[model samples]
Target: DARVTQTPRHKVTEMGQEVTMRCQPILGHNTVFWYRQTMMQGLELLAYFRNRAPLDDSGMPKDRFSAEMPDATLATLKIQPSEPRDSAVYFCASGLAPRGSGEQYFGPGTRLTVT
Candidate 1:
């Protein structure tokens, strides 16, 4: 049984610092997604990758948000020059099936707070 795992489930940092969050998607899954959730934005799709290739990232703020897949099971999301508004729960999800037909299994999430 494989499950998505996230690191640093809770993080508190001062403003303008770099933060890195990681995730391990389920095995045999090729599609990975990064999402941010907050009071203002219920669930914002930041980006996704298919077969380690970026599919779409139009929902992410290009200035400070970045996502990458270093390998098959590992994915990462990074925030630079962090701000208070950037504080939220970041989730990494993986699709067990095709990009459109699969249900996404989400990690526990990494809670980031910038003050």
Candidate 2:
């Protein structure tokens, strides 16, 4: 069966360490998204992509994080010089475009903890 897969299921790093998370969306899904959830802010959409192109990432801190689809099957989110406040669970979800026509498939998610 097809599924969304995220790498390094968990991560723990010191304040200045860089973190890289990866995702592989279910095959054939053209739209992908990145989301982050923390106790304080709840869930927030960090990035959106369609057909391997990034469409929006305004919800994320531009200087600290980056989201990209290197190809059809792979999506990546990276945080450089991570801070303690960046601790959170990050999720990658994929679905068909045209907005809400189908259900979204989400990966188990990558959990990051910065100290």
Candidate 3:
């Protein structure tokens, strides 16, 4: 069976550090999504891409956060000068398109904590 995977499932860092999270989407999937979950903001779609091209990233902080698909199987999220406010669980999900009715497969998210 195919499944999405993420690395460094948990991380704790001091403020002003840089954090990088990685994801491997399910094979053959055409779309990938990144999401952040926090107590205040709840679950927000940070970004998504179709066929490895970013579709939208308006929900992410352009200055400090970035999301990208470097190749067909890999997606990455990075935060420079990470702050306590940036602590949250980040998730990666993948799905096929055109059918538009199936559930997206989600990776076991990466949890980040900044002090």
Q: What is the C-alpha RMSD of each candidate to the true structure, in Å?
A: 1.4, 1.3, 1.0
lDDT of 3 by residue, 1-115 (tens): 8899998899999999999999999998989999999999999999999999999999999999988899999999999989999999999999998675668999999999999
**Reference-based lDDT, each prediction:** 0.91, 0.93, 0.94
lDDT of 3: 0.94
Q: Pick the candidate with the highest lDDT.
A: 3
lDDT by residue (tens digit), candidate 1, 1-115: 7899999899999999999999898898899999999998799999999888899999988899888999998898888989999999999999954535768999999999999
Clashing pairs in 2: none
For model 2, the stretches where C-alpha displacement exceeds 4 angstroms are: none
Clashing pairs in 1: none
Alpha-carbon runs more than 4 Å astray in model 3: 100-102
Rank order (by TM-score, best first): 3, 2, 1
Q: Compose the digit string of candidate 2's lDDT tens values, residues 31-104.
A: 99999999999999999899998899899899989888999999999999899999999999999988657788
Worst lDDT window (10 residues) for model 3? Answer: 96-105
